[model samples]
Target: MLPQHADPIVAIATAPGRGAVGIVRVSGKGLAPFVRALIGREPRPREATYGPWRAADGQAIDHGLSLWFPAPHSYTGEDVLELQGHGGPVVLQLLLARCLEVAQTALPGLRLARAGEFTERAFLNDKLDLAQAEAVADLIDASTEAAARSAARSLAGAFSQRVHALRDALIHLRMLVEATLDFPEEEIDFLQKADAEGQLQRLRSALAQLQAEARQGALLRDGLQVVIAGQPNAGKSSLLNALAGAELAIVTPIAGTTRDVVQQTIQIEGVPLHVTDTAGLRDSPEVDEVERIGIERAWQRIHGADAVLFLHDLTRWREPRYRVGDANILRGLPEGVPVLHVWNKVDQAGDELPRGDSDIVLSAKHGTGLDALRQRLLQLAGWQSGSEGLFMARERHLRALARVGEHLEQAQGLLTRAADQLDLLAEELRLAQHALGEITGEFTADDLLGVIFSRFCIGK
Candidate 1:
């Protein structure tokens, strides 16, 4: 533990704004004296007592409730105190100040809690594992119903349970390998009798399934950024509004009406897609300074997007000027980013069809062919429409799982390559175990812990 972890910490537990109620929380060892100084009494443990908060001068500061939790029972496994009162910023500040003032005399080494310090303490105290600790933040930051549900599952140990399952299987396999290496004479027979090859293959199969599910979870947490790009009046804004099912961007027949990016988050099959409608892509002497800036920003966003929806005006596809502008946009799109050729105004295009077989023709004005477009976006994201057992996961989890798979692959090769591979096989298994431990933070570094926790909201 760091020296700072030994000291008591205090902070306003609620958001920094007026609410119906607010909380000022404190946690540390030997917080009894500090509690009595602020509340005038210890009250019952785990119970809320309504009373008046009096100052050192015997003046009433405010009337509210206080709850007490002794060590090994509270959120941080320390003696914790919570002062609940009006949610006004001033009242919360005054209450926070009173705790500090009383701590100066009643308690020593008391200071404000750092962001995520409280939850970090919870993990250190064995109240929650590292995965659950991260889930606490994920649950708060979830933006969609599916994301919130997945995060809630993770907080409930769904992800941790899966990781634990993998770790247990790996440990079992390691034990068998170690036992074989112990008896050099019986090495081959021991492995064969225990079916070591079978275990490795099964483990690899299970890991593949886990990787697919984790990819979905990561996609749920961090959705794809889809940028709508095309010539002016290709109905780029119309496509955005149509996909979002709202008039988020100003749609006018006049070209260059949308002079800025319009972004909106829309969910397809419970997967969030952050769709951005950039200014119409065009380079013309008629373009003004503001439109030029918008066009520049559009390209920047296009380069960063995970996917691009290159919208085309079907009604003017025969025009030489329109075809040239469309060709220019196709050339400008960033390489490696998946591009979906979307043809809008199909209702106005009559029987004329685009040359590309895969081009999606849609009438943004009438909402026709929208279902096909949504399905295509989901396909581009690699989302299985009805995948079961999905949970919230970070990019780090995916990397760790990938590393484990790599080590396992090496171990499997050793099983077949040579009989003298016992020592090498054991080393590979050990590395795989270490990689698995990183997911749940059983083998995490202090600096990584700091980086992870610091992203959390204060007083968490």
Candidate 2:
């Protein structure tokens, strides 16, 4: 824990701008003096008291409800006070300034809270683990309803509970292994008698299940990045508008209307999809400098995309030059990235909507076969239908779980090699336990905490 956690902190807890109400919050050890200084008396604990918040000269600053939460019973495990008043930006600023002024004499060393400092204090005070602290920010920044629900579950300790359970199992297994090492002289094979192999197998199964849920949670949190790339006038902008249900991109009959990347985020069955519509891909010496830059940016986005929706203009599918251009663009795409072939402009081609297991056929202008496209996008994202009880997770959590799995696999391999290599097995188990501990912050560094909490908004 840092020494800064000991100082009293204050901030405008409500968001910026005018609203129905605003809150100025202060948290520290022994806030009773500050409370009396502001409200003229110590308010009842855990109860709201109607009072006039006064300045240093006893002039009324604002009339509001004051709530005082005594130490060990508040959000930060400290004595916390909340002053709720009118939401005007000026009014909130005045209240905040007055609090700081009064604190200069009433409570020395009182300072403004940094971004996410309040939640960080809670973690240092044992109120929340690292994962739960992260989830508080995730919950506030969730873009979709499903994302919000998953973040809420994580904030409620759903993810941390699983990590703790896995860690406990590992501890028990380690105890059994170490005990066997201590009594090697005894015959009867203690490990075999204890069914350590069976225990390890069960642990592996539980880890696999936890990993799958964490992957799903990560998908809900970060969502999929899908980039659209094709030849000019392949209806890329039109497709983006159709998918987003808005004119997020300008569509025109002209081939080069879209000269830059346009982005939109849409949800399919509660799964958020971040779609980027890029400038059409083609080889042309006549192209200007701006179009060339746009095309370069398009390729950059495609390289990073989770999936690329390669659109094909059905009306121009048979042109030899068009075929060459499409083939070249497809070959240039980054390897290992999933590409979904989409045949557009079926209405103009007077073609029946091709049915089968290969590629999506749709007319973005007419909105025909759009449902098929949406489903295909979802399928490409690896989204499982009816995903209930999902918890929000970040990339770091996934990496920690991966490392844990790797350690366990190494232990399993060592166990099969030789009974004399028990030390290696113990080391692997210890590493696995450590990896799991990182997820819940049982093992973590101060630098990591700074990086994690710095992303949160001020006063969180």
Candidate 3:
């Protein structure tokens, strides 16, 4: 905790808007005097008391409900006070000003809270761990219902519980290895009797399973980026519209109808896919300046995409010039990005389909073949259909878990690929446990904690 964190803090807990009701919250070491001065009475603990909030002039500022929570039991593990009144911006601001004015005389060292300060206090007080603290922000910023549910689970400590389980098993293994290392004369017999090799294998298997699920959760939080790219009039915009079920982008027979990047987020099986439609990729002397810029941006988007839908016109499949253009687009595509070959205009192909392996054949105008495309997009995003009970994880969590797995792999190698030198094995186990601690913040740095909580809402 920092020196400034000791001061009493106040803020408008509700959103900045006009609604039926709003809240002005205060948290500090001893807020009873402030609450009594602001509301003309000290409300009972954990109970709402209706009263008229009075100013120093003995006039009513507003009539509202005041709820009090004594220290160590409140959200921030401090004495909490909430004033619920009308939800006008002016009303909230007045209440906030009133708190500051009263604080000058009643509650010393009081000030307005910074962004995420309230939640940071809660974390410092041990009311919630690092993972749950993150889920607080995730829940508020969730873009989809599935994401909200997963965040709720995480806030309730689902992710932390799994990490704790791993930690407990790890502790047991570390204990066995340490006991053996402390007595090297008994190291080999001790390890063989305790079945240390079997324990290591089982722990690694469990870690792999958790890592796989965390990857899926990460996709749910950070949606996949899919780019639609091809030559002019190849139905790129139509495919985007078909996926979105809306006319988001202009569709026409003209080449480069889409002169800019148009993006839409569509959920398939509750997993978000941010699909981008770009201008046609082509080389022609008749290209305009704006069209050339659009083509350059199209390549930029393609290079960044997790998956690229390289749409082709089935009606023009046999032409040598069209094939050359298609080959050019393929050559420009960045390596390692998964490309799905899609042949469009199937309804007008007249049975002369492209004689090659196409991932999908569709008529975007008629809304055909979209279901397969949606499933393929989900696959590319690594989403499993009907997956429930997932944790809302970030890239940092995944990296920590990966490092844990790596250390465990190294530990297994020390046990099998070397002599009975138990010291190195014990160090590997220590590193593995340290990595597991990072996920729940048992071994996190202060700067990392600052970065995590700084992203949260101020009122949290």
Candidate 4:
């Protein structure tokens, strides 16, 4: 009942299609007038009333339940109304159109809601912070039950609360440092103070621990990308088929049956693994241009992966000299990217499989040595598949934590320097605090919110 000029925004809150019910949501000021024009009665706040929804000309549309959540307490922190009707596509469309016509007459400033606009408004009104707001979408889009529960925890501010705790601790430390700086007489003592150094070390330790958790969470959310690469018929595809426990990839005795990179996504020990088996790398003069293209693309995938499993067929590669440029592949891979040397088809050559240099001899056909390979993969990923204490996170969160870590490292270096630049230390602490804030969206850009929420489904 606030005013007449604020146009109500309307959209179908429920997903499109036939279902048990569909929800049409409208939010804005002057919601009462819009409801009055549509249903001929103003609904009590937070009440559900069975009503016959109608058009501007007083024609019945559909019989449904109307819910009114008025003003600052609503999801978007506005006067909001929802109409739940039977969900036939045509019926839902007609109901939506009828409501829109009523809104157009009853309110002003109304327009089609943009992607994530409702959530954006909720954020602006302080109903939720950026991290919690993002969790709303994450929960809805969660692919697994565990993922949904983790996201729900984040939406409830579990992640943000921890971040805030760290922020508060950092602020206190910065205050103490700056206070000592104000008294130049004590600055020398403070610079050499054991307590001060101890506090800094403790803070760094806490940040490091948080970074580890954030990393685990990110892996839970994004999973790990593992690509298998080597010469043709080195059991790359066979290995994939074995791990997947199904015929996800076609394996034949003939080499090059897999012309393109074959991919399969499987959850092992709760860690999502995106496994790719690429076409073999060979220098065959008989091969055509298309095969060459696949080989080039194979290398690209290998370079982009989180980890590469370089397989060497022991029957063919008898000695270390015959090992497929094992040194060259290691050199080409980016530093810090883990490589697993797998000697496949070991069943064919028992004691002949190379023993030195961290090699695991396995037969993809018999599923021998698979458990060892799995353990190795989990180790490289920094945790076992389906490991406990995992949560859902993202690259944005990790990058923010990493920035904080870098700042802390830089501050430690400055503290050890000859100069007692307390001011510089304070600046680094501030930067670290800001970086941590970005993880929970206490400090962020509008574009970032757009990007994060845009990834959500339309109804969300």
Highest TM-score, which number? 2
Which residue pairs show backbone clashes in model 3?
A: none
TM-score of model 2 relative to the true fold? 0.97
Question: What residue runs in model 4 are displaced by over 4 Å at the alpha carbon?
Answer: 1-8, 57-59, 181-195, 319-336, 384-390, 413-420
Clashes of each: 0, 0, 0, 4
TM-scores for every candidate against the unseen true structure = 0.96, 0.97, 0.96, 0.87
- The TM-score, computed over Cα atoms with residue i paired to residue i, of candidate 3 is 0.96
The parts of candidate 1 lying over 4 Å away from their true place are 355-357
Candidate 3's C-alpha lDDT? 0.88
Instruction: Name the 10 consecutive residues with the lowest summed lDDT in model 1.
Output: 182-191
Clashing pairs in 1: none
Q: Which ten residues in a row have the lowest lDDT in candidate 3?
A: 181-190
Off by over 4 Å in 3: 355-358, 417-420
For candidate 2, lDDT tens digit of each residue in 1-460? Answer: 5788899999999899989999999999988998887788999999999978877677787898999999899888889999999998998998999989888889999999999999998898899999999999999989999999999999999999999999999999898889878888877776788787888888899999999999889998899999999999999999999999998998888877788999999998878899999998877996788888999999999999999999999888878999999989988999999999999998888545443466888889989989988988888888888989999999999999999999999888877753798888999999999999988898999999999988988888
237-279, model 1: which lDDT tens digit per residue?
9888888888899989998999999999999878999999999
Q: Is candidate 1 or candidate 2 better by TM-score?
A: 2
lDDT (0-100) at residue 255 of candidate 2?
71
Tens-digit per-residue lDDT, 168-204, candidate 3: 9989988988887677675366777888899989999
